[model samples]
Target chain A: MSETWKAFKPYALITPQTLVFLLFLVFPIVMIGVVSFWEFNGYSMTPAFTLANYQGIFTDVTLKTYLNTFKFLGLVWVATLLIGYPVAYFLAFHVPKLEWQILLFLVCTIPFWTSNIIRMISWVPLLGREGLVNQILMGIGLTQQPLEFLLYSDFAVVLGMVHLYIIFMIAPIFNSLMRIERSLITAAEDLGASGVQIFKEVILPLSAPGIAIGSIFIVTLVMGEFVTVRLMGGGQSASVGKLIQTQIGSLQYPLAAANAIVLLAVTMLIIVSILRVLDIRKEL
Target chain B: MQKRALSFYLLLAFFCLFVLFLYGPMITIFMLSLQGPDGALTFPMRGLSFYWLGQVFQEQRVGNFIEPFVRSLLLGATVMAITITASVLASMGFRQRFKGSTVIFYMTIASLIVPSILVSLGIGVVFQVMGWPTNWFSSGLGAHLTWTLPIAFLIMLGIFNRFDPSYEEAARDLGATDPKTFWEIVLPLIAPSLLGVGLLTFTLSYDEFTRTSLVSGQNNTLPLEIFGMTTNVTSPALYALGTLTTIFSASLILIAYFAYTAVVKRQRGKA
Candidate 1:
């Protein structure tokens, strides 16, 4: 009776979560794999297997779109890291205390407290033809007319993504930086290391874990992104996400599922590679 | 020394400029929402009127568009409940040193980073094939859960990972049964996380678009309504709606944060 009870406890504990996962997570993914091979008419998919959907994704137009999406992903990733790093650095090292640190961190996150749609729409009015950026530029005589490239451009998409995701970058770096013992820095100082030297040798090396975590999030999410790309990219940018949306919207479920599988595969590989490099499992 | 001062000034200037760059557009939208069709976007002479605001609330097409708000609220609440339950169980399960735990944990991590567009499409396709009813009380809730669960699980796990297990052990040693120890001792320790995850899950569900758009089928959440409004008619009423939604969302976030913080502080005091 004791042995049976002991075995039952863990099973009982895991039952609910495992059931949810099987119903919602694992099952859906398996179903996606199954559905991607089906045939789709105009309105709905047929219950028959076909590779036409996968082949359709390799068309010249889609290929171009796929390539553009990758380009956008690369741009967002590099830009976010370049801009986000220094701010994160300032927060981690330049900030004096934990209280102020948390306060500043809260400031960064407040914008995200609102809906993402609201945040993105906010960009439209500011960058629209009669918007503020144009007004400022016209006021300064920087352009003869309102900048046509302001609102519906890759620049806007990257700007919105970076603005929203900068918090993701900062949070992890802050967590890792906070974990570094003050004594380590003091010890480096005792050994006659300068601020830059300590940062380069000690701080940077140790904070790599956080950097890995942040980059994983930024890179992966940016790649799979649809909302920012679709909204700011002005229907011109066809990211994998947007493509998937188009498929689903037009009732091309099989194609969408295939695209999703490819995306999942790409992201899983990126995460696995990053995990190998960072060994984040050990940190936890 | 001069170079160092220059850098400091430059940093301050950059950060200030960035702040404006980040929020400048939002403020402009807020101002624009108050304006009417003509020179209201411009200055002087014409003053602000409640024209757009009235249009948003009174016009049958716009004013009566309260269904999405209700739908969003319903979806958000359902997602909150589902995610909280799933995350708590998953957290506890993962906490135990079990076989294949690493694999399960990694899979959950994968869900966190996978793009919303991708998983949403996959899930949508899966549901369509499986012929899951895309009704408000059925498919809508499931779609919302897909987006909410991963983040909720991550947050709950983060909290649970930091928990001191000795409390649970102590409860068990005190003649409390396993389930009793878990409910009375373990749950309280992780309650703060539950609240935080609930708040975030609710927020995500409420604002969710890509996933919602795919799986919603005919269901129109607030985000879906906004999408339609933006694409179909570039009316200022949309801006008014956006602003109102933003305020509603911001208030929810503030309330949830305060409630969670108060609970956490009180729990700590009791301890």
Candidate 2:
């Protein structure tokens, strides 16, 4: 092959993958950014530039919704981390056999392949007023009335978010844990390191990239989340995503586009901050 | 192994609870779907019957599930083929230091983190501005690609990272051209993982909601239909539908896992 063709081959091979991102991702994002600056006439967007949409991000309701989203994001990130890290530690260090480890990990992740909406809906029967948890409580005479807050409150939103997103946390943390050299742990133990000391000094630091990736996944997903809040919160909550969805539903295109812009900026800000702490790409 | 530690038992118990937490609600949906005609959304299964399951099959108020299922199936298969092919190609290309590689890498990574609603709305608006009508195959297909490609890329990245390039060098030394080397050596080594990722891409597209929500343009995908049912149908029929679809997905994944495991074992044995 000629040197030029050889040099060009990799780019040519990647063109299809590159084109999809340009058309679907970059162009559309630029479109949203442009629309965010345009004026809305109550029905359609006109050509004039305006700051109203950007200004709306600071409005009381908008700010409150963003706060609520951040709350969910924080709760879900911490919950998943608390739950996921131990699970990864167990699978990576505790599991004795490779085959069993793979099997159990698949057991944890298999649900991820199914419909998330169905999984969310599945919670309705388990946590509703007349749901299984309440039934169990009343059946044991623990309550005079079924607890109403189990399904439609912020609790439900956080619970559903945790349930839905724990996988994102577990899979990555497990991946990082598995990649840790086994001999490092042996050496640490041989040097008379206690279990806790070895763990704190060795495993946690090595798994930081997995934890970072997991945190990014949970934070971004929870921040942009609307469906789980809408489903589990039963109109009792407001998220920035829901705000955008509502505005879009009402034909408020420019305002919704503006919300989209602010949301993107906020999401990117969180990710950038995370990247500042640890570069996830380097591990990859 | 050093006699299992006390901490191992504690962690084992915790892992058991974790698995129970993951699957308990799904089991409830599964059991509730088997309830008789008089059964409700919650417990107290009146009797055993397939009444709600049948109801899901012959759709009325919840809209036609079958058509949306077919559309999702088609979209998923299309996405599976394209994502696996594109990601496989790009994964190879990425091995070389091509121009704009960092930009493409970040873009793909951004594709994963960018809000799906934003993607849906952005693509929906782009189609409108371009005066191009969005269909499940056109705009919907593109939107699905945005979701699947990044994931496929990651999986391929994992597979190719552990791949030692000296194997390819040997093939080249044996007078194998680039295509011959890739097809003969690289493809065989990566085939099992590719199969798994392909199936995963198909399933992800099949169940995708947020990205496909605004892009599907009238002909709904199964996820859109199911989400609609969540608002309108409070009956046990919803559980029945969930049970069936979840069962189908579980079977597909379980089968793929075993098949992948078996292939890896056989490949190891041969080597």
lDDT of 2 by residue, B98-195 (tens): 78888889899999999888898899878866879889999999999999999999888778888999999999999999999999999998999888
lDDT of 1 by residue, B1-271 (tens): 5755666666667656666766676666677778755424322213466667667666555335678789888878988887898778777777756666777776666566667676566666666766775655566676667667777777777787788888988887888987798789887777766777788788888887766666676768888878767665556677677778877777777777778888888977987
CA lDDT, every model vs. true structure: 0.74, 0.88
Best of the candidates, TM-score: 2
Model 1 has a DockQ score of 0.51
Error of 2 at A265 (Å): 1.3
So what's the TM-score on candidate 1?
A: 0.90
Evaluate model 2: give its lDDT.
Answer: 0.88
Candidate 2: the clashing residue pairs are none
Q: How would you encode candidate 2's per-residue C-alpha lDDT over A1-284 as one tens digit per residue?
A: 57998899989888999899999999999999888888888887776788988897888888999899998888888899999999998998888899889988989998888998999999988888898899999999999899999998899999988998899999889999999999999999899988788889998888999999998888778877888889999998999888888887886778889998888888989988998997787567
User: How high is the lDDT of residue A25 in model 2?
Assistant: 91
